[model samples]
Target: MRKMLDLLSLKLLRRIEIRYRLINSFLLVSMLPLVIAGIVAYRESSSASQEKVRIFAAELVKQVAQNMLQQIEKIESSSEELAMSERMQNALAGYYSKNPAERAAGHGEIIRLLLENYGSFEYVNQKYVLDRRHRIMDPQVFAQLGDGVARFAEDAPDMKGRPYWDVYSTAAGQNSVVMLRDILFKSNNRVAGTLFVGLRPLHFSRIFESVNLGYGSRMLVIDARDGHVIVSANAADGNAPESGLVVAVARNVAEGRDNFVSYRDGDNKQQLAAFAPVPHTNWMVVNITPLNALNTEVRSIRNKIIAIGVLCFILALVLSFIIARSISLPLKQLVGVMKATRTGNYLIRMDYEGRDEIAVLSQRFNEMASKVHQHNERLEELVAERTRELEQANHQLEALSATDSLTGIANRRRFDEALGGELRRAVRSQKPLALMMLDVDYFKNYNDRYGHLAGDDCLRAIARVLRTSSRRATDLAARYGGEEFAVIVAESDSANAMQLAENIRNAVAALQIAHEDSPFGCVTCSIGVTAVQVDEDMSTDTLLRLADVALYQAKALGRNRVALSDPAGATG
Candidate 1:
């Protein structure tokens, strides 16, 4: 009985030890991989997302700030021009010059100046002058200044000081933007009157509207003198706060440390702010974006890792030892196969048993392999097709480039090339060559009367006549340029070339195209023929010029006529 009990206890202990060892091994094996994968995924995702967010934010801020700087420059230069205006200075001198009649006369001149050039000054809403006494001199003129125009007359206690821009709400129920200047005399350099121009803030906003930052980001121009938001897309939100961020950023910006800063919004959300100062104005621009919105992927990745960890723990407890071994062995094989994909062997695949994620992975690998094979096949086919297409395209391009668009004949460039070769050949073989030049008569008036379509038909008919009249295989026909054509005949004498020219002219005249403006009482062309000789130093340019001169003589003498030039003394 004692021996039997010892054997049974030993067997039970072995079973318990095996279960514990299996559980521990499987847990360590499965959980370690999951943990490593989670850590690597989180790190890679964070790095990529951060890089993308940084570039997007930096570019957005830089472009918006640069555009606002340009607008500030325009406004400053324009204000300088307005301050130096002769009519404006004379008007201010009249307003502050101690006589009511002079002031009235100055007012009339100022009104005429504003009215005469109102269209030119689209940005300036109204112009006004404050007298030395600081009293409201012309209420009618004030009415014309509109409710948005703010005037601090020279007589006020605050008016004893210097020139500055004042932005405030006016009694005229307008948001007034005003520039104040102490007008001076060029001779004595004394203060004349306060020259003020009132502009609406809305004018500045029109320029800002064209700049794009991002979908939810904004470019804000805030007054450094005050916390008022001047021009911004966020102004329409109605819930955006009057920013203390602007004041703090402007102070830092003035000290030359223009770096990005973080702040909280009215909704208590954290945001990133970047700003720059406009050089001549008491205004700074701010670009703002929500920080969380920018780095949203970080939170999403963390949540996913936690969820995966919980799932792995459940799976570790449920799977049996033998089953876990089976899964682990296949997984190791799959990892090796996946590694092969990085080396471009996309044909590698894993063997899997059950219809789970791993099985789906196996199926995906097979599909990917199939697609790669198909893509390789398709790539080869595409390369073949593209090669054939390129050859055909080359042929078509050669034809289109050498031939005329309207007349289906060789064009001037082709003619130049051909003439050079033929001249060389004629010099080598001691053969004669002839050139014929022809022009349309009354083509411009024919176009004006019957339209360009009829004019094109007439040119085409003339080209056809020249083509038919020249019957030799060595003859070449070409469109020289607009309303002009030429032919080169090899081994043809001057007598035969002149006869061919007459034949072309008669063929075109026989076409019966009407030209009421024709000096010959019919639609016709002028022809010039010149023969090239062997001993003569004949070149393409020289032959073309001689033929052109003969063509000119034909037109000058009378239309519907042919003229010929002897080229016996032609030179290179």
Candidate 2:
């Protein structure tokens, strides 16, 4: 009872020691440093992301403002040209003339001038000419002028030759900006009428359409005069919104300040806004990005860092447990096995399943016990068994090295050695030898119709047929290359060689493999047969060349047939 109690106590102490060591090592080597690094990395990444968002938003607003300024400058240039036109001055003066014919002639000349300059600007969608009497000459222009003509006639007359740009609703209820240039009479230098050119708000909205400003962001074009939004684009859905943070930014910009602002909205949500004034116009481009969007990104990174740290902690615990069990259990098993072996039990073994040094030691111990068990029983038999195992291993290695992996026949290297040996034997005996080269008819087309795997199956089937046909002990068959095979038959004349070639062709045809690409309506082979009497002048290479020539002939003669070749020097 005391001995049993001491054994249990020793086992428990070993387990506790292993557990404590693994836990302590994990805490010092992995967990503590990971926690510290995760905190530092999260802080640095959050700051960099916030700075990137600010810089991106500032650049986008500036680009939008610059694009708007260019459009405005184009409109201003077109307006100034029409304001200085001599024909325009004459036409405006004629509108107030006493004679009806003068007004009719002036109307025709003005229409011609407008038609010539119709596509002169890219942004102008429509042009209108209005007189103080609110009369428009062109009926097409009259239909589109809407209430904008009355508004322009009232306000534009005060500007003399200067251009006035204002956003107004058209007759179709679409809002657009109308550039009204005062047409003056050159005789008295007084305003005679106004030229109205309507610009689509879509042109300005499209400027920010392709700019991605993250989630819940918006781009706005505001009238600096009254803090009114002329155009707005919601970055989330690419749609126009009515009111946003642009109103406050525009008011600030109108007070002669162009800058960035951060403030809270009615919902108490933090927002970032930037303002840039369009040059030579009372317009400002404003970009408003929500701060919570950046915070969401930062929070995502923080969660990821925390998740990785937690995952590391869990993995460390699991690995420590696995390592402890792996080491302690195997060592205990080895000790028990050793104790049993010391008591004359040579059949005991350890059931360890791993590839580490411990597993190797356990395997060697089992081997030692197995040897000791068989030591006196059959020493001679053990030597014989080892010799047989070595011989079998050598045979397997030789077969693998010589055989084709795909076709299960002799490979090219083996084929070359066989051919040389056969030629030398045939020369020494002065006996007749025949070489036959076979090829699948249009095998490339077969591979194209089927897949490469099917092609491999076809080659294997062909190899089996060749092996069966050349089954004599003296005959050699081999895979020469892709889709090509060769056979060497000893003690055969031309007649016997032709018979063997015909047998192979018929066997392949009997397989009936589908070949839509071949004229035979199934897979077939072309065989080239050459029989020669061995001599000192003959060589293996020369014999192969003759067989190749015959193979070409067989393919040229509408394939699926055998052809015979003449000797090297004895041509037809």
lDDT tens string, model 1, 233-279? 54474323447676566566678764566667767777766666555
Residue 23's C-alpha lDDT in candidate 2?
Answer: 66
Cα lDDT tens digits, model 2, 1-572, are: 64554343334333444446566656644555556766677677766865776778778888988987787777689767876788877876675676545776777777777777755656667677777665566643434464556755575435544577777766767666777776767777666766777777776778787887785677887776555677776423322332345556655656875477676655677777777777756677877778777666666766676567666566665545545655766798899889887767788888865455567788998898889888845866888999999999999978877888888888887889888898899989989989999999989888888977999999999999998898798898899977889999998999999999999999999999999988898999999999999887778888898899999999999999999998856432
Count of clashes, each model: 3, 0
Model 2 stretches with alpha carbons more than 4 Å out: 1-50, 119-123, 133-135, 139-145, 152-161, 205-217, 225-228, 232-247, 250-258, 264-269, 309-572
Q: Model 1: which residue pairs collide?
A: 134-155, 537-571, 537-572
lDDT agreement with native, every candidate:
0.68, 0.76
> Candidates' TM-scores?
0.41, 0.42
Native-structure RMSD, model 1: 20.9
Top lDDT model: 2
